[model samples]
Target: MQDPVVEYINRHPNAGWKADMNSRFSNYTVGQFKHLLGVLPTPKNVIEDVPVRAYPKGLKLPKQFDARKAWPQCSSVQDILDQGHCGSCWAFGAAEALSDRFCIHYNVNVTLSENDLVACCGFQCGDGCEGGYPLAAWQYFISSGVVTAECDPYFDDAGCQHPGCEPLYPTPQCQKQCKDLNQNWVDSKRYSATAYRIASKPYDIMTEVFTNGPVEVSFSVFEDFAHYKSGVYKYIKGDYMGGHAVKLIGWGTSDDGVDYWLVANSWNRSWGEDGLFKIARGTNECGIEEDVVAGMPSTKNLVVDSAVAAEQRASW
Candidate 1:
């Protein structure tokens, strides 16, 4: 039997996105899919103390730019991270963006730990795992910097489990310390963003990505999005789930000439074109162009000597 979501997508004659029944999300109920989306709180104003670099103007930007291609050193580009059943996409998106920016800024590659933020960042960011806000996650980065994935690996449930199946995953708790899976502790000062900012306009978001690296973006996820395989996604028909966040890495036109923003998702590599999806650009389909947040890595954090010295002095 065809899933109702699949049938809805298949039946839509002019739907801009293609639907795939073979994907893992084919049988997910609307409620189950909606549960995966986390609520994003309103973005707080930018911190005035942090230095904000003005983006260069009058320079021609390429019609397309892929952060992965431009900075292959960033392993996050090739890797597809999974948030499992937890509604921690907010943390994942912001952490991934910061990871990319850290790499671009320092020319060093390292995966920042979303688990660190998801579990350690308290109510100020949002409820751990249950839901969170991307902007709040970035703000958390500014106040309490996060650690690397090597120090605090993701502890959420894996996506291979059936959609409705409960995997006995415990609620995440904030440790507020940097420790690896083996329980070895690392210096927290080595991995944390000094500041963050929100970019709403489409051009601003693009400029941030081109200049800094990927930026965290949130958008409304519809039921039909579960079946997205390829092509530029435009909302066709589906229940409106709450907002979901992802890392916006680049933008370009598809072979069919449809414009799209390339985004990295936290749903695992098995879903949505190897855990990456593209949505309609310019029109801000699903409010993607509206809520965008990014962060800058603290230069002091990038320097091992300074970071270690600061850690010793408990400065950060």
Candidate 2:
């Protein structure tokens, strides 16, 4: 019996297979040889910042969920193949966080290359997607600007071949070799967990964060996402445990009265109504109230187009 990683690599022809099960990955617990997967039970509800106070005025949020405006806006939640059923939520979380910030910082609304991060950012952090830190992933982006999601998408065991897509920024040989830039980007996009953990008001931090633009954050999907076959999911299973990489672009509730957190999922439009899903707010992922992490936008002097900046100020 070949190892899951090796077995996956064997079936695939071109993917650069790199795996280290021993490395500290995300929240999932892996048994011997992909036998069984485990997830960390939702920790006791610690007093964290409510998502209402942070929310920008007029922005609608899920009823049960919290953290409305905790961080900046992000793109959408994308579902990448878990890859041979490997639990590497930590890597996906980091990639998702960076993807949204990358788009906002550059003002581009394209998907980010999470696969590249999974394949490349190994030695620096845990390997095989078992565990990782959002902070460390941000640092890597500073040192290396990731490629557009168009260049590389997470391939399932079947593999991918999107045309004109290359993992590197410009050069083929230099793929994954990011441009060295000032680390200031890190400070600007940094999100603080403590802030969300200590808020009192019903602040919609997610709304406030998106007021500027979409930002990325990670969360555990409890077994709920697995059975999520369509319109407004509330019931979830306890057998599955995994960390999924998703983007949170905007929020809204449906007319059904089942308050939902409008999130853009990456499972391709086919999975959930145009790749969009409505999680039962706080129910999934230990009540969205506590799962707040911000991808702080860059605070560097806003480089406004001279024409646009002047006109905007005149109106003000």
Candidate 3:
């Protein structure tokens, strides 16, 4: 007889219900999914000891960053199958982007704490593993200040809890009754900057904005929750992912010459191809430009070609 879990996944449209462990998680009932939703990981991971310094002024942009340059070299996103067993793709999206931007700004590769954002930012914007907003979360981080390290993760799980788990910088709690609409705080200095004007593209905008500093982007990843051990991913049948999270770093191309946005995933390093997966460009998921924000050179100060700019601004 066919496995019941496989049967359920098969019955699901696009096979979206397949769990990371097809054999184990495949049989998860709705109640189990709900239970996984609220439970937090035990041990929080710690942030690497790094100095939070001012962003370097006048960083250069590549001649033209596209799928050609984005996949194999600049960045990568592996499916973090079961970090929290919670489906909070929103938190992952913000945390990963910050990690990449932080690393790039400092020219160092370090993992930032996703649990910090998930636990603290949840009340203000993000959902507890069930999904949340990315841009709103970024605004939350910018206002809240440096997050606690992963070592003292907020949930109760073995993943993040460790002797070293603690925030490297001061972590700020959310302000009640915030006055900023769009839930964003305006910076007088940034308001006067040129980069603020160019943050319009929603796809690779994270890469652009992160080049100046860290920015967050959100998208859905619930379909990735099940049977994620395999490196080869085939879009499932009925598995309906109601939006998840991941972070954007840089762009690179896959071995297949396909353009992909590089992302950092929190699903431990075991899931997809050693925690790196390439996603299509120009579309929503890995398309970093889909959720563009302001104040980055690539995003803000594009030396637009006269013709293209004129064509676009004709309506003006």
lDDT score, candidate 1: 0.73
Q: Taking the tens digit of each residue's C-alpha lDDT, what string does model 1 give over 208-238?
A: 7887788888898876787788778999876
Please give each candidate's TM-score.
0.85, 0.52, 0.50
Give the Å error, residue 215, model 3.
5.4
Say which prediction, candidate 1 or candidate 3, comes out ahead on lDDT.
1
Ordered by TM-score, highest first, the candidates read 1, 2, 3
Off by over 4 Å in 3: 1-82, 106-115, 126-130, 157-215, 222-236, 285-289, 292-316
Highest-lDDT candidate: 1
Per-residue CA lDDT of model 2 for 171-227, tens digit only, reads 112244323333233222322121122121224535544443333344555433443
Question: lDDT tens digits, residues 1-316, model 3?
Answer: 1245445554556432233443434435644443333212211111122112233335555533433133322242222434544555555555555444433333333343455555566545535454445544545555553232333333534443356653121223433322323332222101001112123243335335434444444343344444454322344433443433454445545454545555445555654435544444455542334444322111111234556445433522
TM-score of 3: 0.50
Off by over 4 Å in 1: 43-57, 160-170, 177-186, 189-194, 304-316
Return the lDDT, model 3, position 247.
48
lDDT of each: 0.73, 0.40, 0.40
